[model samples]
Target chain A: MKEEIQDNLIQIHDLRISIYSEGSYFDVVKGLSLSVCSNEILCLVGESGCGKSITALSVMGLLPTDVAQVTNGEILFRGQDLLKLSASDMRRLRSDEISMIFQDPITSLDPVFTIGSLLTEIIRVHRNVGSSEAENMAVDALEAAQLPNARQRLKSYPHELSGGMRQRVMIALATALNPAVLIADEPTTALDVTVQAQILERLRERQREQKMGMLLITHDLAVVAEVADRVAVMYAGEIVEEASVQTLFDKPQHPYTQGLLGAIPDITARRGSLHAIPGRVPPPQVPPPGCEFAPRCVHALEECWESRPLLEGSGEGKLRCFNPQPLIT
Target chain B: MLIVLLISSVAVFYAIRLSGGDATAAALPGSATEEFREEFRARIGLDKPIYLQYFAYMGKILKGDPGHSITNNASLVEMLKEHGKNSLVLGGAAFALVFLIGVPLGVLASLRRNSWADHGIMSFSIAGMAIPNFWLALLAIWLFASTFRILPAAGCCSGKQLILPAIVLAFEGIALTVRMTRSAMIENQNNDFVRTLRAGGLSEWRVMGKHVLRNAMIPIISLAGLRIGQIVGYALIVEQIFSWPGIGQALVTAVLRRDYPVAQFFSLVLVVLVVLGNWLADTGYTLANPRLRRSR
Candidate 1:
């Protein structure tokens, strides 16, 4: 077992996951490698069902039973292989060492529980604290997440709060123990434009204060542009490209990445038609073997349809393509 | 306060109308003279205006003496109290039986949606829905009382006897509850929050228990509330059929003899039970939904 034992907070090697459907197993995430350093944000950008959220869920060991299964892979956290850990041990590690905030806050929280109960449950489970003290800490965490009226709001139920407030409460619950890593899976997908911005901003603020590593899975490129330090472009359950955000945006090497960038509508651009990807993201059940995006690639070559490209580093960026898109002059 | 009073007065008016004003005030076909009828009307305070009579009845009811039965001389309040207890016991037991069996089965079927387990449970639910209550009650009596002779067939007593009637009473409720729970569970399974909880590192049990069950229960609570009155009403029929000396059997006796006061009192008790059931359901719903509290 090769263990990269430096400052890496999380490291995954040769992780392979398959889903059971219709009496057959289909590979959802092929052999994939990823690393997240402490106090950094890694963004996974892709269209829907690209295995980005699946990868994040795998790291938390939260894959649903009867469908998704981690067949092969080793998720190492703090020099310990997560898959090998006992369920009892992993339960302790989940909310304390690595926490997660979901996409929709409205439904994520229990309707019967007050915000105070929800927040305090996490605190009491992970921390050896009394209820009164835990409640005070929960309120502080909520305030840290920038929720107004933290004291009064704690008494309110999740439905009593606005969408934005509920999201903040979720953040507060996830961060009450100051976990080392936070996985936010499409955290702003359900919110309005303005609320989305506020939630992202709150997440970034909390990440910086806690100096916690974050694996943010999202389909929205704008969100990634605003928050990511490194961006991994996923296409049909594979990371086609990985590079620093500035490098990926400044000089996109993958045709899929370029297509995504092109698809982003700019409000300031004048007299220009909005660009769209030619077709929808292909369903994962029968993903094309050779380059999944070859069918949609404007710059596709014959080799792209015959041979799949392994992720190879060329200069400052890595891309999995036979012929990476050339830099625009 | 005004609404409650207005509603009470309306109920009273309807009750009086249904009983044909006052039987004693009208002259008897063969025995009573006009002078005797007029004197009896004055004695009973029926000679006064309807509105004044209403106030006097309301006063007596509030003071806990709901007047005496015209035929039996039994106090309406006492009769209601005795019969209401039996009804409550039967209804409560039936409810317990229905929910205890229904909820878990519904949840299991939902979790294993489209599986054989789901199909079997649904078939049972359908059977429960199709079977009529009276027939089921009679069947219970025949099987337990007449055929095997293990139970007495009717009356609120310990043994195999209560089982059949309770089961018969609960069968439809269980069916309703199971269908509701299964559908609610199915709906909750697809909720984004449930997905989110699963993604948030919760195990399947935790997700279902904490998120799915709680949310799914909201609708079930409302359904239970609406069904409570019906269940109690059904208890009356079941009790009469089974010779269970409960409210319904007593009601039949009172109604058959045209004991107007006793009948009216029993009806009022039922209405009160229904209203109270509704109130409890509302409170339960509010407790389950945070959005409701915030809106209020």
Candidate 2:
């Protein structure tokens, strides 16, 4: 267990984020804890507005200051607390130690810059390298991302490339510096199914090549099944379950995780309809007094409505529920 | 573009002609006999049908001859060349002042957004835009010329004298440019790419100065070109206040003196300048935006 904790490249502890809107602040991410271990991909599975993107931004120190604030908790990168770093220190650590790729590839790159300049600039910023050396490194990164005509693509602007190609460029850019940790927020959500597979393959290949820890955020369960080594299910800003991907998919304990697994449309089943969790995730501004998923759970007991459940468990797994669904055979 | 010029020339010719004063009557004195007036009208070809008169005027213009001023008999082309240079100098100085001051001030305001400096700069710009140039000109002359004894009260052709009127002309332009730069920078700063740049470990200066400013320059360059045309329009009043010898002052004089050829020539020049300004802006827009460049 101690060795496992030491292997984590990025560990987030009880992170709470608040967004100021209209007149007051609301907790968007309540005391959420997760980690990304070296050579493993931890898929943060959640629906939109469940604070997945916010969590990623906080780790990168890219959250907009006027709107969102990290009210509590620490994000530790390799045993150093990132939240305590100064602005310049955080900037220095970013792209050099940790990097990120965003969801929409269309708007992720600067339209006015050529692909060559964009890649070269990031390379030069993080490493003490000249332009020619940086250019070579950029070409290598592009090739690593499996981009075709990598050398010729240097002069092309973002608009000149197709969506898939741009996303490839984004992946190349994020991995260019060979950071220890990579945070990808729905990286394949904007691509077609074929392109999505290719991009995910590239990401997994990059992780294996570098032994980098990756926090892959996605709402698609199929994607979770494909690339995740471990899975953390989030509902309304809190983790409901954490386990090995096989365990989570085969025997989802938390009611929310079960509902998520059941909601995935199965091609082999001759069914009446797909299963959907009954109620929506409650808004953070006015959350109910108990477990956030209790109102939507089929196994909610009388005690589930009284108070929130602590995340408690033994080795390799954790569960936060008053009454969890029974294990499947 | 040629079609627009042709249409504007026709409008200028007819509008000046229909402005309720006979060219022959304005040229000849009341003591002159009807025979003298008739001879003058025939000499200038005004006795012909109105359409023929218009055609004659156009032919002369196409031949690079705008006829002569009715009051002084000076060549209209020579007058335009002399006065056009002064207008160019004044307008150029005013334009330079507008951008050099406005852009940096805008950047500062945006960087310090919602601070006291931002509020102060914005409030000043609002007041600058609200004040009329004529009023501002008068106030400047009173303060700088009459009170301080620093500048000449009214005149032109000197660097020192250029200062007062140029500031008066550039006041509104500076205000407009500030608003434009600040808003454009703020808008681009909110774009998704900004976050990408930040997450890429770029320094705040490089991100804001290089990327954000480059995107912001698209609208700014367009505004700059349009402002050049507006400066010339505003020059008419500014020159009148300063008694500066420019094309605008020349146009006003020609109109009051009923110098038809000179008035028509100067008006056409102003129209051509405005059209040229818009063309420059379109070219600048294409240059600043890569997407537009690739589309073309």
Best by TM-score: 2
True-vs-predicted CA distance for residue B191, candidate 2, Å: 0.7
Give candidate 2 regions above 4 Å deviation.
A1-6, A327-329
Error of 2 at A61 (Å): 0.8
lDDT per residue (tens digit) for residues A1-329 in model 2: 78977898898999999999989899999999988889999999999999999999999998888999999999999899999999999999888789999999999999999999999999999899999999999999999998899999999999999899999999899999999999999999999999999899999999999999999999999999999999998889988899999999888898888878888888888877877889787988898898888788778888888899998885589999988877653
Scored by CA lDDT, what does every candidate get?
Answer: 0.81, 0.91
For all the models shown, what interface RMSD does each have?
3.0, 0.6
lDDT of 2 by residue, B195-260 (tens): 888989999999999999999989999767789889989999999999999999999998988888
Specify the highest-DockQ model's number: 2
Q: TM-scores across all candidates?
A: 0.85, 0.96
- Candidate 1, residue B217: the lDDT equals 93
Q: Give the distance in Å from residue B232's predicted Cα in candidate 1 to where it truly belongs.
A: 2.6
What value does the interface RMSD of model 2 take? 0.6
**What would the per-residue lDDT of candidate 1 be over residues B1-296, giving only the tens digit for each residue?**
34654596568556654666455633244477878888877887778887787777778777888887767688877877787777767778888988999999999999889999999999999999998899988887788789989878776766455777778889999998999999998898877666545433456687787778988999898767777877878877888888776777787776666565666667666667677778778887877665675576
